[model samples]
Target: RVRNAERCARFATRSSTRVKHEGAVSTVQVSVLLPECSSAPSHLDSVLNNFSSFYLIKKLPVYELLDRHFLETAVYHGAVFGLSYRTRIDEDNCVALMPNGHLTLSLDKDSFEILGFEGKPSRFKHRTATRFVVSVDLTDSSMAPGRRSYLRLLTSLKSRLQLQTDFLLSHHPGGGASIQPLLSRCDWSQHRPEVNCRVLTNLPCPAPLSCDPHSFLEWLGAVDAGISCENSSSSFLSSFVCPEPNTMHRHALSVSVSGLLLPHDIHRLLQELRRYVEQPRLASWVSMTVRGFADSPVSCSNHEHGFLRGGENFYTLMMFHDHTYQLHLAMGAHDVCPP
Candidate 1:
């Protein structure tokens, strides 16, 4: 696993350099979240509170200089570094100590676990860091399992380190309900899909807008039309309006499609829409009422069909109806049909 992590780190470094040379925005800002610890170390705590932990790699004189300093500092402190980076809107760096006690690095490819800890291992050939935002997690193991301690420790180091720039501590959820409320209160401009999707998925639609539902439907249809024109194979798999009689309430509608569209394609579209929704320049009155389905079937006829694939056609229709009905209940505020 360690070997794989090294490989990933190397790849990321290379990719980052390519992006930089391409004249794209090369600077990335990272916010580290640390778990609360009962007995935090003073040096660690000092690091956590400091703001210079974030640094720009471009400002460094040489890669070897920084690499040597990083290694020496880490070894002197007897700590393991959990490397992370932001590549694109949906892709971000995340490394963890897995449950089985192996170090795993999730770096744009399949995660790799570290196999050994000693000796001068082969360096993963990649670009050097331009800057770093480090942080540590120090929550007690008995209270917080996994590498929460490591995360907390990193957070602390991130705070005090003067290597790059200031460290930003990401918002951490206290509980299930806490997430939705926190998301609701966030400044959308600061929302990154990779970091916030899990929270957003659980959040209920915010208070509905006062726009005409029919007008909104028309706009969505036009957008769908444009998408279809751009990609001919795409089709409106299924779409329906809520049947409930409530006219004052909002409605939830979905359209499903199946084609050559891969999961990555769908994900890209969703990410684009998310950015649009977060745009503060847009009118606050405008709201996004649609969600895309990619990897998973948009609508399934029967719940059982999901588990059994023999009657695929029949179950697919059933699932669509089920989803349609549920939308009615949630948006129209009436359980008029079965989801």
Candidate 2:
């Protein structure tokens, strides 16, 4: 019997809205709402310094994915990281391999069937058999060197269309240097995640303790997008305003890091944000957001992530000084509710 079967809540076990419906949204939004706690954990700065670094793989081959040496070093270390840089359109062919060693390939019908691996038809905007997904576990024992499954995929990637594309790769603990072998085979460049910080003056902030997660996140999104929130409902341009029961922050700090960010680093950032709220300061709260890779093979956990018009899978955490927090995890329609 499933443990805690009787204790399961309707929210966790119920059929998810994401799975049953199709929309412009195709992501898994699962937030872990946390109760207020008292203190912050230490060792934040050290963790931040060790965040994974991103790299560029120019003209990387599909068969090189089976490189035993590179796999043994980086992938085996549990630092899976790879994704195609997305343009405004035609990003459907994008490939993303998460640190969990899941390689997700978005393909057309010909490529999907020709590659001939186990994959499912895409759920987004696909009334016909147009798009497909091939999600393979690179770390699986069956995928080991020279195995039947491994060779088949290698042959498909090598002898088929001979696919090669630009990829952004990252590694944790060892950083990008760990994957140098793969980079040596092609034109590649290394990059670190860009961090930007700013201080806003006279900012309208929803009450840290009172605001709902969805509305608060919306407000934060507006801030990030630099849209004027003073508009009224009748305003033709935009109608976004602060949530009710709000407060004013004469001074607020905003820091953003962008790149192929890994989850391990995000967890460290969360720990640091909690500490910021614990300190005695004018600000009563601190908010943080972690956006998932749109082309991520797995969303929330192992569940498949799909993309439509908007592959929005992300969560915003509002942590109040009282140790209470509201986490809003949002996903698009082509995913299960996030865990």
Put down candidate 1 lDDT per residue, 284-338, tens digits, no spaces. 2222222211111111211110111111111000001111100100111110112
**lDDT of candidates 1 onward, in order:** 0.22, 0.63
Give the TM-score comparing model 1 with the true structure, all chains together.
Answer: 0.19
> Where does candidate 1 stray beyond 4 Å?
1-85, 88-189, 192-225, 229-319, 323-339
TM-score of each: 0.19, 0.80
lDDT of 2 by residue, 65-98 (tens): 7788877877777665777765211244657666
Q: List candidate 2 segments past 4 Å from native.
A: 1-51, 87-91, 175-177, 232-237
Instruction: Give the root-mean-square deviation of each candidate in angstroms.
Output: 21.4, 8.1
lDDT of 1: 0.22
- Distance from true position, residue 149, model 1, in Å? 9.4
